[model samples]
Target chain A: MSSSTQTAQYNPAYHRFTLFLAICTFLLIVAGALVTSNDAGLAVPDWPTSFGSLYRIPPMVGGIKYEHGHRMLAEFVGLLTIILAVWTQRKEARSWMRKLGWFMLLLVIIQGLLGGLTVKMRLPWYVSTAHAMVAQTFFSLTILMTVFASRRWIGSTVTLTRHPDPGALSFRNLALLTVLAVYMQLFFGAGFRHGGLHFFPHVVGAGIATVILVWASFSGILRFGNIKPIRGASIAILGLLVIQLLLGFGAYMTRVVWGKDAVQPRPSMVATTVAHVAVGALLLAHCFMLAVQAYRNLAPAAELSPADQKAVVA
Target chain B: MKFRFGLLLILLVAGCSKNETPPASYKPEAPTAKIDPSTTATVSGVVTYTGDVPKAQPIDMSQDPACVLGKVPPNFGEAYAINKGRAANVYVYIKDGLGNYSYPTPPPATLDQKGCRYVPHVLGLMVGQKLRILNSDPAMHNIHSMAHENDGWNESQYPGGDAIEKTFNKPELMIPVQCNNHPWMKMYVNVLSNPFFAVTDAEGKYTISGLPPGTYTLGFVHEKMGEKTLKITVGAKEHAVAGPAFSSADIK
Candidate 1:
């Protein structure tokens, strides 16, 4: 259970590949956001084919670039996910990890179907919103797989043998709550972007999510700063939150204020809105990772009876 | 790595099999009956509004400098072109009572993109009639046809590019055409089976002449205010007046 012994279990190549896949997934998200921002969801008009040909590259002009570029990137990401799953199944010793890989594959396939449905159905608000939400989920899964394959996770497995700290347990619970709040806010944000829901709910969700995230990050830093993984993820989440807020404000100004009279999607509006969405995805992933790290590094206090707690303390 | 390459090959092959051809363009059949000018009646109307008219909002075309470099910026609030309570751009057409007597298709309709706005905000054309979409502005524009009944298309057109020729096969009430490059640029294209439709001009006056004598349902459609129908009986060589008044309550 020692750190040095756990190092033997770490697969650096697999971990690096997973991290690469996660980065690509994030880029795919950015591409998808650009497509929505440019209002080019139906630029190609057909699914699985761009302008009636899949192999032949269409003219990447105007909205077609954003729409077709997104599809190409998604295909690349889908290929990466397939490789990741197959590798995990063949090499990973953990049965749960293998299952997680296959689950990611399933999610990616579902994501692709939802994207096709969004286009074939002419961007129905619900289908488009669901496509956006599923992209977030797929990105989070990649992040989770990346975290699971990290050396830190392997080394921290020994923490399970130590006595459960009640404070860390509460912090873990708070991190989980923060993750849920961030996800709910993302749902509202997707709904607003797709025109299914009004902006009021998204704004309100942002306020609530910000409050909970700030509380969780500050508490994690103040109480669990000694834990490397928890402190690192908490600090990253706080930094991402600041950038996300500024981007959100810029998006609002560009989209609602300056962009009100714009005949077309302005470069500034598209940039800021896409950045806000990208940062929102990053914030969600970081929040989820923080929760996962807390759970991995700190055992739940509820699992220990009073006698067992006393014995462990002694 | 070999497995990954093999999997990629499989995906590429799998994608090759899904060759879905684009839907065929709809073409309307030629008219069967000829119109008699001597027996035809005229339907004229003044589209008047009873409620407060929405103020015209100034459009900011600064996003695309070419939109205002040498041209006047269009008014975004053209959605409600009301002059002293008279509404312009209202599409008044025969909704019913044509009795399957088809009329000859009219000449091609032109939807020009000048100053980053559709020249005619609202237009009506016979089904299967050619629609020439021209981009006269210096900036790039994408013409997106949001047609529910017909095939939808989104194509980008460069400034001074060749005109895009399109035709609708079915009689759809209205198909919204927009330029995604400029969100403020929008126009409605109404396709009809017969040539008995007219759009109200600046004075809110619309005249639809050469209609065969018959009982017809006149449909007045405003972009914001939903459709209003009126039953009218037109006599031969007679001029029928359709004074359809749309109020704020009719806003859809």
Candidate 2:
């Protein structure tokens, strides 16, 4: 089948909306990071409400600005996710895509619950760490959905069947491994933030994840540079990796070196730490996107089962 | 001879009456000794530091403009609160030797958040004594107690909000209380079983009075200097002086 045949199920508006939701999710991650960086997780004290009222707007002063603002943005993104899921279910032709839509909804619901639990339990390390991990998962799912719905993804499916690359499977494996490494690193980072894990684990995980990410990105560029989706994602991940490392160092300096005697959370500390967390989320999402693209567009058709083949075309 | 016999019989009867047991309703009087200042002992001490004091670092309250609205930003690196050679904010308490004597809870202690700082940074209160937290600044504050032995709690207080009254049910030494909104606002609450504890003032002077005369382990705790203990014997109506000298090497 040609690209045009596969394009029938692709909705341009839905594709754009998915991308928009993904961006919003990234922003929400930033806001959430701000809350942690400022230690404002318990500023509002109540879950699902600011100062015991759902409708009443509490004065956004001090930590409330970061915490309550994060909640507001989170609610907006939740609404967006709901619309995206419902729209996908009603309009998408693929059963797997519809399932994915519902699954994303479920993940988002769990993410919100984790958020509430983190606050209600007064920022328990486990719950807060879970909240951070789930957020990254939900964000990665959004990115995956966006890539799957793109025009590039539709055209690549047809093109890959005609010209099969034997190294595609290895590349896909490498990408997946990079995803796991990055996700584990993020878990350790979140654990460190919530005081569940020590800083040593996070630091060690960062080094290992960095090596894997660099190797995977280089492999994608060297072997599959012609593939736009794979190359683009690889480049994005590489760029974000650099920025992440620098932000990580900046965060460390502000939090440990310069802030050693700080009486309060300094603005620089909050800024650097929040940016580091935001960039880390973006890096994870992009890494997952690369893995998905490699799996769907680079892998040989013979390796896919009949169901997988049908889902790919659909 | 008859009168002498009568006298001897009378004397024998009196001696027999003295040897007889008392009535069932008869009870002896209670002891008059109590835990009064005149009868009890006082522990007076000065916490002195022999090493160089850490200089205070200027706090950056620019994150919240309300924290520095009209007042100058304060420096806070001095974790030991050393002035001249004396240490302020040192919690001096009778750590041991009060065997079975129970004490009533003291009056409620007040901790205020003013200028984005905790007033009376180190406080000692008896177990079950109320702690009234007030926000005197125009900024919002959340009091988060990081208690290990007691139940931890976090509550928000808006600007000009009502005072938050809390009581610790267990004896927890040095429970850290922090304002998450204003991270610089920190305090340590010492929940003690007895009322014989005092925090050193600016001059490093502390007097723990009304202590029953006995040998005790006087504990001196600082936020950064770890802890030091002294063995002292207190006599009735005596003022026992126990001065603990902390060195910079003791900083932990």
Q: Which ten residues in a row are the worst by lDDT in model 2 chain A?
A: A305-314
Candidate 2 residue-wise lDDT, B60-179, digit = tens: 677778888898556564475888999999999988987556566688999998888888899998877899999998888889998877777788887899999988877778888887
User: How far does residue A67 in candidate 2 sit from its true spot (Å)?
Assistant: 0.4
Clash numbers, per candidate: 6, 0
Per-prediction DockQ comes to 0.19, 0.24
Identify the candidate with maximal TM-score.
Answer: 2
Instruction: Give Cα distance to truth, residue B192, candidate 1, Å.
Output: 5.5
Model 2 DockQ, alpha carbons vs. true complex: 0.24
Compose the digit string of candidate 2's lDDT tens values, residues A175-196: 8998899889888988988889
For model 1, how does the per-residue alpha-carbon lDDT over B1-252 read when each residue is reduced to its tens digit?
366346434544433432355555555555567777899999897999988765555666665567777765454658888888899999999999886576667889999998878999999988789999998887777788888887777776768999999988788876888775566678899988788899999999999989899999999998889899999999999998986899978765
